[model samples]
Target chain A: MLLIALALLQTTPVAVAAAEEPIAPYAQSNANAGAKPFESDGMWRAFHGREGVDRIVDGLVERSLVDPRISDTFKGHDMVRLRRVLKEQFCHLLGGGCAYSGRTMKDSHKDMGLQTADMGALVENLQAEMNEEGVPFFAQNRLLAKLAPMKRDVVER
Target chain B: MRIFLIMLAALVASPAAASDWRGDGKLVLTDGITTVEGAAGGGIATWAVIAGNETERGVGATAHASHVALPDFDLEAYGGAVGLFDRVELSYTRQSFDTRGLGAALGLGRGFTFQQDVFGAKVKLFGDAVWDQDRVLPQVSIGVQHKRANRGAVIAAVGGADDQGTDYYVSATKLFLAQSLLVSGTVRLTEANQLGLLGHGGDKGDDHTAQFEGSAAVLLTRKLAVGGEFRTKPDRLSFAQEDDAYDVFAAWSVHRHVTLTAAYADLGDIATVKNQRGLFVQLQAGF
Candidate 1:
């Protein structure tokens, strides 16, 4: 009888172990019809799908009044370089990840003939625009910190 | 060695010792409001015309008093200033010029007194001395005053004609912090021989006498300042040869809105007259 019982247990294929198997709650939804694997973990999927970059880019285009020649030059030449400049400046100023990769500040403004009064006007314009965009004063000052040092380079007069 | 001692003696002496004139400070240009009385020393004279830098963009008010240290005469004066939005400053002053023994010489009463009132206004023009750290042109200001001689008969009888008119001028004030001093100078086109209402009146000339006014205030502590002022006057009116005015003064900022100023004043040449001494005390409050 013991021999017969052992044979039956082996054929039953570990019923206790089979009953204890863990079931994934989201497995069915994740497997359904080309669903992304990352969606299995809802947090990462939400971050990857966010539209932060697009909103900031649209804001820049709408608010900034670029010089016609400068805008045309940016549009005609390497879009990648122009995009990088915009992203880098905005990200650096607004406290984002991108590092500024451009000409040394002094080299960039070598022939600009910028004066203190001109700088002041620019600052005033920027402040007004930032205010319209609901940027807080504290954040504005933080952005100014990144640009103020360049005054020595930008202001030739 | 002798020159060094002379310089050392000059610093320790009283009025007319050393003439180290300077401006208030670079930071003072935010508004027309300025420290009351001289920035330092305990002698007597009103301080700078304006209060703060143009950046402050606020109104300011100040009052100052001082006494003169002339030979035998004594004088006392009270003055106040009102600055509007860093653009304009209107000032009013009342001065009492007393003659001790001089009154006897003039055949007046045993103790005669001359009094006057001054009304002043200042407007700013282009300059970067207040805001730009790298600029040399001090913030330039244009000012004018209507002098109304109070003792008309007394002044006319003593000095010939009591000229009452407007005294207009321009002033530039700059502060050199690295040197711990302030420098200011003014040019006035006027007929008044002296600042006194009893002196020669205004409507004097268009040539504008280049009267240099300067102050050297040492920053003893951040809140305490000690200094003196030397101002040259135009005696274009035949009544008197303008005697230079000088004072030793001290000022204290008790709080952000309040300041107390005290000084010993020596207003020179009252209608060809010299050596008028007096005491001045002033209280200034601002919003």
Candidate 2:
């Protein structure tokens, strides 16, 4: 049944277009529908301005502090510095051209005995922050896809 | 039952004590429960999602028990599956089919049962079901199931060609995260008769034929999903006609490690018993 529906949609150009339509809640218009996510620094910068970036990081840190699953890992850390480095790292990865000045993922996470669960918790917190900031799902996914490879470096167990 | 409890206890206890479990790295309501064949999927159809919460860097395993009670028949299955690197999956399932009064009528003796074993493996070909929101392409997987029926003589007497066979399938699954919708389509080529319990092939058709299976699910909450599935079947027996199967199900993730699913299944005509409708329930524990 799903295959038949998909085939039908594919045969009808208008239906296919409608199916491919973006459902971004924060999208002002469909003007960027044809634009690829993370294709250019301009797109990244426009999707989340400096203020949006700051808010996203702030949201992430706030959520992490209360998330029992990973809160222990954050103990005794300087949240202010951590937040600044995270913002810079995300900006750099998203093509904002803000060079990351923090330690490499492996070096920073080494000896911390970070587990896959901790990485998962952090990702969830980041996702929630993205949601709060009204970041487009596509944009968030693109960013995540870039950061996903770091799992090898961050997770020791 | 004791084994099931032991497995569930181990899954929960070990994960909690060691903290080695992957947790919620996989998307919520995305890692579906083990299907009857032990693959991750809906009631009757297989999806392309990998099993458990292995993600792309770790290993995860799940144990499941399912029961399907029909008007004239009942099926009980238990199995476990393991996902490696969120790419390959291997599973094993044991099924016991009770024909109830139908067994007596068929002269196989009252309360006679037929048992079968299924071994399955699947590999993800490409795409990401959860994170590929920017593209229309869905995750695709290719899989195979090898089935062996214990009652070879009975199957041969019923005009079955072989007591063992293999089924091959290709499945594609997609998740529209923002819309909280999931859709999957699978095409299987098989010559199995009654899912290989009645054996493979038959006098009517001794060759493999393509069958369709599909599912659509909606996430009502982070931990709850409601879905429906349709699976076409092969009519291989000359004695009785077989029809398609379908189910409407709701699954709840009670915790990161446990899921419970309940469904209303319409298996159409199985053997000569028409309208074999019933309730299906499955419990899965994983990490």
Candidate 3:
């Protein structure tokens, strides 16, 4: 009976999680998103809800990947995980009812040797994507206001 | 000394190679418009912001011209400024005040012009006005302006004592991105009359007095801002009472390299003319 049980266990395969490349173990919280969520759903609606925000995040990442100003910073990093966390972060900040599961801005950008120009480049890319979604200029600033403060932690140099 | 010169050149050129330090990088209009005094700020008030679009790693330059047409006078200023690594700013401006018909009334002949040259320097001390949105700290800087006027005889005839003087100031500026608002305040010490156009010192007194300049603006869009400013002046001239100045202005970023500002300005009094209010326009270009 024991030998038969051992053979069955050996044949069973270990599950590969669909969450993408693993990160080191750390506690996750929505607070890791940095700023507090908008007090109302107007912001979320302005962003066209979940689908819109996800597209914006993916679009920003894609643009940054090709942007020579900051492309090297993204090289060799797990973009799949980055896209996922960034979406979570934007959704939560926009009041889309999503929880963030990522490291602090300082931790995530650590050792990147990023500069102010790099931060400026990332902001421009994000702005272009937001504009692509037809977000109004005023509402665009509302989101930018929330993200601008993160520059303190995002730019190490 | 030759080796040191080579090292200095490398120190500056290596960064240029690394970052391509130029324009089109800073957020729109964060550089502010050129002040009439030639510093980088509002049309009338000085802020703690550097002069150009350069970040912490680059060099930037700006040139500007401004005009104010009053009921009895015309004021014009033209100048340029440079920002080094967003750290130090050096500037120069030539200003001319046309007394118009008032010149004849004051016995200085018709269309008499009071010319002055202002040389200014500023250095950033601490904080990041734009990026420190999460912190209460504001960017601060100290500056000095050496002003020399051309109409020494006219100034002395009007009870003035000197044709040249220096003004010192410390400024603080803060930007609240969430509210799309920017505010700046400056405290200046000087003995000049009429912004050093008439001259320095007076029969009233030659002691340097503290003056205040304050401004607040709302960001209407990425390329537009509307604001108001108030500046207090010293009542230095015994021959004519001097008053404060104020303005309400609109600044538009028409392109990456151009900014145009229009204002309703009030200079209070000039020489003997009272309620000197009028239209003011300025254009600035930067890289």
Candidate 4:
């Protein structure tokens, strides 16, 4: 029964950007997500599949936009595309069966001049959003474990 | 002159925290709480964590007051530490041990107190313990603690060889986030007896010997962790056997800037008093 519900969640429509600004062309691959997916679907079910990943991404991006420490970093960026790709990236990393259509972490963060503090602030926001979704602390850490290494790529400064 | 010194210190510190001064950027408790010896770590064992809320680009500080109440003795430590760029750490701690009524039994006057000071420095070599989850390497650091004991007469009477000595150590620490676990191991070379509270070296052995501090913690939440630590000691003075120490501890970050630690410590034996178990508590304010 739980598996059936999780499968149904995968089909639930997640919000996509109506339009995205075109940028310099780059190759897209699941590899661009910067982390490999979990081997078992247990992680996907733990995340409540697509619906949970969508909410977490939307919530994280929304929180980061207003967060004083990291707000300046998000200004003038394509938030719509950011939200969509974040969902994809999260879904893929969580083994939710979604293809990541984003650029590599280093390339996308190019010239952003992000500092370690910015990455820390963003991580704090992500933790908050994940907590708001009632994810177990252990499961939250599993996801964070995957995302943590990306700090090297995402924070260039 | 005082104002000039303060300004000079501020000027020296400002260059490292290039990230706009407010160094409260690292995740909560990642900076670690102050150990009894004034280094960032668990209750008793010094870890590889830098003592600050800063990460790679900021300067921060930590201060702590710790107390341990043993059956026949009581110990107190109060100190502060400065963290530079989350890379280098300097700390100072003053430790005082009160013998209570037991002092008179050893032919010393009542309430004989032993006081000592520990000045410590640690430098991180490499690896990000908290961040490098994809890798197997743990964060490593090397440190030195120069301890000075004040009761020279008592130390000499007990056959202790030196009143002051230096301890050298290297530590490795890692957080297995996926497992909600944190582990640390430290190897120290020292001739200190009873953590240098009884002075350094001894008639039995004046040479430095290798000791170990090992600990493991379960990360319960973002701000709470419970752990256990075991530390080996050098049995320097034959007058009284110096034994190992162990503790089970819980550390909670009540706020981002304040932490409280409580522990049940078995210090084994001290000054011929056997089974020196007690309650250990610490309050830390940082960054």
Quick one: best lDDT, which candidate?
Answer: 4
Candidate order by TM-score, highest to lowest?
4, 3, 2, 1
Q: In candidate 4, which residue pairs clash?
A: none
Docking class of 1: incorrect
Give DockQ per model, in order.
0.02, 0.12, 0.34, 0.66
Superposed on all Cα atoms, the candidates' RMSDs to the truth, in angstroms, are 22.6, 12.6, 8.8, 4.3
In model 4, the runs with Cα more than 4 Å from the true position are: A1-16, B1-19
TM-score of chain A of each: 0.48, 0.72, 0.87, 0.88
Between candidates 1 and 2, the one scoring higher on TM-score is 2
Better candidate by DockQ, 2 or 4: 4
Candidate 1 chain A lowest-lDDT run of ten: A30-39
- Candidate 3 clashes: the total is 0
Best by DockQ: 4
Looking only at chain A, give the TM-score of model 1 against the true structure: 0.48
TM-score of each: 0.51, 0.72, 0.88, 0.93
lDDT tens readout by residue for model 1, A1-157: 9579546534433343343323233322211211112113232222221123323333344333373312332233333333344445555334344445554556545676544434444554455555554554444443444444456676675
Model 3 chain B scores worst on lDDT over the 10 consecutive residues at B1-10
Worst 10 residues of 2 chain B by lDDT: B1-10
Which ten-residue region of model 3 chain A has the weakest summed lDDT? A8-17
lDDT of 3 by residue, B1-287 (tens): 24324433543443356445634457878889988898998988999999877788787777788999999999999877877788998888889999888889878899999999998999999988887777888899999999999999988888888999999999999988878899999999988899999888899999899999999999987789999999998888888899999999999999878999999999997887889999999998876
